[model samples]
Target: MTSRDAKTYEEAVEIVLRTLVKAERIKPTQYARRLVMKEMNPSREARSVSAGLLYSVLQKRGLLDEVIEDVLEITDDVTELDTWVRNAARIAVNEVVFEDGDPDEVADVLHGLVRRLANPGAAAIVKAFTLDLKDYEPPEPEDELDRLKWEYYHPRWLIERWMEMFGDPDEVVALLEANNRRPPLTIRVNTLKVDPEELAERLQRKYRVTVEPGRFLDEILKIPEGLPIGEMPEWEEGLFVIQDEAAALASAVLNPKPGEVVVDLCAAPGGKTTHMAQLMGGEGKIVAIDVDEVRMERLREIAERMGVLDCIETHLMDGREAPEKLGREFADAVLVDPPCSADGTIPKNPERRWRITPDELERLPKFQYELLKAGAEMVKPGGRLLYSTCSMFPEEDEEVVRRFLDEHPEFELLEVKVGDQGFDMPEACRLFPHRHETCGFFIALMGRTG
Candidate 1:
């Protein structure tokens, strides 16, 4: 709780900014938001003010770098300082450039932050802290790629990949720009607990929750704005699960029926696993295998909360061994929701871009391939093996599927009925961030021909 006195906005800003650095930057705003809720004086107004500043800086980080170039001092080899200094500077500059505060006061606060957190030299560098707001200007990049790179807030290599995928210059820029927007609040109803329409009515009547039926799936709903879902009584009662429309579609495409044995190979934090259980009307068994025990706990919790605990069993081990452990060709369906570069989720998980390197992206395909192959091995003859990733890359999606198809002659691409509710994708379909207003996702539903 905040002290009896309302915390100053500056104090709140510092607390949030510092926590962003402490928690690490992949999802800086989310990390910092949690920290403020837990540690900062519980002042709703103050927290919002701080959080507002924090999110702006994170979302427009590239633009901020371009606009506030004069503020940072870099050597020949390094154009950026370490994370602590850079983060504090970003917070400082965000307040100075964007916030409605006195420039000098903002600079003073920032200088103090740097001096305390970094070193004297760092604070001294920006000590003057004077700005002619009108006179300040962003530097122009020499080439087209350089210009788009900083402007869209994506790395040059990633942008190049998009350019290749999109082909058109304008379309590529539009795609990256769309990723910066806040993602929609899409949720899937736990049909095992309550029908979607019934749940929507209950929510509307009781809490006046604004619930719109999903564009495609009757079991899904779009909640325009929501309080923390976990806090909702209906959520505790397991009425719905918060899932992206694209991810929910993956489970739907798998379409597991009641009494069938299903397997989710990469099932930690199992949104799709529980969704499959719901699709089964809580009658079938699902072997949910994941390497991370801690994450699987959440999966278990979701299953238990959704009243489908009897249908799902979670195992703490490598999913690759499912064929051995679960028996060969034992599953009527297998879902491989492997961890890829996760580039498609940049809108929802903004910090992903900052954390991923070109080298790192190159290494994901082999791991994804292994997971997909494992899912295929466990699929019964004519059973579906649904391979999905929150990644838009060909290497992780199309290329991997192509390679798998070539090696396993018996398994062929299965038409997936997804997109705008119930359209068939000829082979595999991509859910583009810009086109679909969902995370960038690629799903390939392959089947054993027998």
Candidate 2:
């Protein structure tokens, strides 16, 4: 019954700065929302402005840090500075240099902010930006990979890795350009509750936002200008759930049928699980397994909201334990969507490009291979097994699948056909942001023939 106080840009900065510092441990968007709820419930306009600023700052963080390092004339990395000072300088440079904000205005706001934070060290960086950041230009690298890294605001090692995989500079550049773009807001219509046509018409009429059919499935819809689904009544009514086209296609690739027993590994936040349930007309059993109890709880909540909970059974355990607990050769279809560096999600989670390291990339395929082996164990003879990931890396995709297939000769790769999208590899479907306008995804469908 009380009116919330208005939130300022400085408060937003405080939230974003703290988020950037903690983003390595947690998701930036989720952490920022938590901070927003705990600190201030701003108006829609204020929230939009803060969200835009945060996304811009995080998206170009690499280039912004470079600008800050240039402005400070320091040979060392800017990360060595105080947290408050470092983040403050990043925001200042991002706004004035990258976003083309008025330097005097940015300086005035940040100076007051630094004073409030009571960090004398931060004031120097803010002052430095006010003076030198106006006309600062980053030096172009002579090397091609280095040029792409600086120009696209990506890590150099990642660029090199992509170049090696793609083998063509133009294709790599296209992928990089695609990753840098803002991702579209796509939602899957919950057919259990309402049909896609009805839901699309309702959304277009009620919200007045542009809605179009998605590329992958008939039930999928795309909103060019994204709506705040959480606050929308249609979302609360569970007419739809937010999901990407490529993610939805993974379930279709598996093609779970009604009355079949399906197992979903690592199925937390249950997007594909629920989609499979819908495909089955909510008549099949989906054993959803995940290690994180909290995320499993969320999956249950989403499944319940989407009116597909009756078909989905949630289990809190590691996906690798699924075969031992559930018995081998039981499931009609098994979906193994294990963890990875998630480089494919860079378009939506720009912070991911910086967070992913070579070590993590090197270690993930073993885990993925193990999970795929477990999934194979659960599939009955002549049943289907689908291994999918939102990763563009060949090591995580083809190499893991190759290892699994070589070890388990009973499972044979099948051609993946989803709405006329052809696979270059002929056995697995790969979706790219530049070509398919979706997240970089790999879906390999296989059948057990023992």
Candidate 3:
């Protein structure tokens, strides 16, 4: 590539990295999208390259930092640099050592990018770091859990917990490997407007991208990655919504009926809420509740874009308050998609593997159980209550459900079979990235028994 072309790609990379460094614990892809739109609109190739690098740096951050520290030690530079320079070094190491890019080409582009930040000395550090990165071996932890965590690019505590849960270290490795890989781009067809086949044809014709029908649901479709599918005309016209297969299956398991009143606790960004609307033929009332104003606004926007806003009543309130505020035992069905560590989403949000802490893991299940109880209180006798989470932890999934069932004699576990993919509980269901090629998820359906 020409020097000008290379410089343009580096600029895109710099813009994305600048934003990414500050967006701690937030979805990096959303920030990347925001920056791409607001800042310089780079070419499609540049966006693709930058996005690949951004995810790579985020995913393998631990290893990259190790390499950078090793190089810094060798160069005898103890001075702490700015977060931007450190991030730049991480991106450079990811490109040169892991992605096997042309080292000299990466060095040249990185120098230009770092120069823009007015850190000429930082550029020297990065250049040396990149050159020596390949030869650096990440220090192996003596403990088995720590070694596995380092090897798999996950938290040591999480690796140990998974070992306890699965009782097999090899199985944990398989799951970790799946989480490290880039997940496919999956979207659900707004069947209330267009069928999957027609939407697939339209997407292919307009975007010139391959669209595969999802394995679990007919209304779901998977598009090739890095297509800027959100910018498509169909998206703006409310033809489909980007959703994962496992998430769609949760709504399917609930199977909301037409004219029924359904409650969607923890419903922000409206993936399951909109799916329920479609299943109900847009004929039912969906009471959606979330605590965050920003996320609730996002839910409204998505519901509007999917043409299901009219069927959804959004409330910016804690789901635990739904029982008192919205009344109890009124809704025909309730979906409790409470928050958790979201370990199952690691494949799509790689930074999550490192972001979740032991304390957070302990706290999430308690909150999840409360959300499930609130949803249960809103379900009428004989009504269905589907509890689900994008978490691989039993503490957040099976254990929470177990405790709820133990405490609430009025609720009985009902069967929730989704083809061959099933949870250990005969009545519940699960989807794993290694097995199901979808986000790791858990679903348990219960009936309010008077």
Worst 10 residues of 2 by lDDT: 1-10
* RMSD score of candidate 2 (Å): 4.0
Error of 2 at 329 (Å): 1.3
Q: lDDT tens digits, residues 106-225, model 3?
A: 777677767776578877766766666556555759888877777777777778888887798888899989988887789889988898999888878877888888998999898766
lDDT of 2 by residue, 1-450 (tens): 112322356556666666665654555474455554455554555555666677777778877887777777778998677776777788888878777777776676677677676565677667666757778766869798778887788999998988888798899899989988877678999988898999888888987888999886899999877776556788877888888898899998889999999999989989998999999999979999999887788789888888889999888988888888878999999999999888888888887788789998889999999999988898999999999998888888888888888888888889886532323457788888888899889999999996
| Number of residue pairs clashing in candidate 1, backbone atoms closer than 3 angstroms, sequence gap of 3 or more or interchain | 3
RMSD of 1: 4.4
Candidate 3 clashes between residue pairs 3 or more apart in a chain or in different chains: none
Per-residue accuracy of model 1 over 1-450 as CA lDDT, tens digit each: 234322466576677667667666433356356655665454556554665566567665655555546544433322365665566666656666655546666666666767787777776554453343324445678798888876767777788888887788888877888887766568888876677888888877876668888765788887665434534788888888778888888988888999999999999788999889988988879999999877798789888999988888878888777777777888899999998888888887765766567775679888888888888888889898889888877777888888888899999887765652111335787788888778888888888987
lDDT comparing candidate 2 with the true structure = 0.81
lDDT of each: 0.74, 0.81, 0.81
TM-score of each: 0.83, 0.89, 0.90
Number of clashing pairs per prediction, in order: 3, 0, 0
